[model samples]
Target: MNKKYLFIFTIVIVIFAAFFLLTKKPQQKNTDILINGKKLQVELMQTEEEKTKGLSDRKNLCSNCGLLFVYNQEGFYSFWMRKMYFDIDILWINKDRVVDITYDAKKPEVDEFESPRTIYQNKVPADKVLEVNAGWVEKNGIKVGETIVFK
Candidate 1:
């Protein structure tokens, strides 16, 4: 009788373990980007909702951190500093090369009517856009034609 009870307990434990393993959520990996051999840890904004809210309302961004917007096709992507708290530099990428760069985009004031907001657009069609802290372009010496690699 004791042996029978031990066998049942073992079966129950194995079943629970299997169930837990099957229902467990998978962990997400970090996405890092390399531009001109310099690395930047990025948060991907793939969906329209995510891209719409890109870096807005954030008090600050890390020096080596940025938002990477991935698109389906190359387009003239326009950006505005709406609801932004800090300045940023926008890099327009076509495939793996930097096509255009918008430097030192200042944050817009709360009163849009009083302080007319500036809209920054890529000089050429681009498939991806990277928004990093202001002066990042000059500090890193990133220029058009520089290659960007995703890791």
Candidate 2:
């Protein structure tokens, strides 16, 4: 009788283990950015903290790399060069479409530190924001109203 009970316990444990394995979440896939036949390996920022920190403090932004910000809703968003080490081009995107672009956004000046920081606002409401190396937009021939595909 004890042997039968032990066997039953072992089967139950096996079933529970198998169920847990089947219900486990899948690993996330790496995402890439594409625009006008140009591409960049990107780092996605979906959380408020990630968006706030942004590309600030980074010494340089690679020509083939970018920061992609995703928001929960479409709204008029503003960006600033606060704590940023270099300039970058900002693309305001909504529904994977380019809504506005801010070119060559400069870093905050030391003098401005004591005063109000300059804010770069998107011309239109956007749900996503992409920051790339300065002049990337012109070099790639990306234009307004063009759709940006994400993979």
For lDDT, the strongest prediction is 1
lDDT of each: 0.89, 0.86
lDDT of 1 by residue, 28-48 (tens): 534898997789999888879
Task: Give me the runs in candidate 1 sitting further than 4 Å from their true place.
Answer: 1-29, 113-116
Q: Which candidate ranks first by TM-score, i.e. highest?
A: 1
Listed per model in order, the count of residue pairs whose N, CA or C atoms clash below 3 Å is 0, 0
Worst 10-residue lDDT window, candidate 1:
108-117
- Residue range 69-138, candidate 2, lDDT tens digits: 9898999988888677788999999998999999999887887633327899998999999999899999
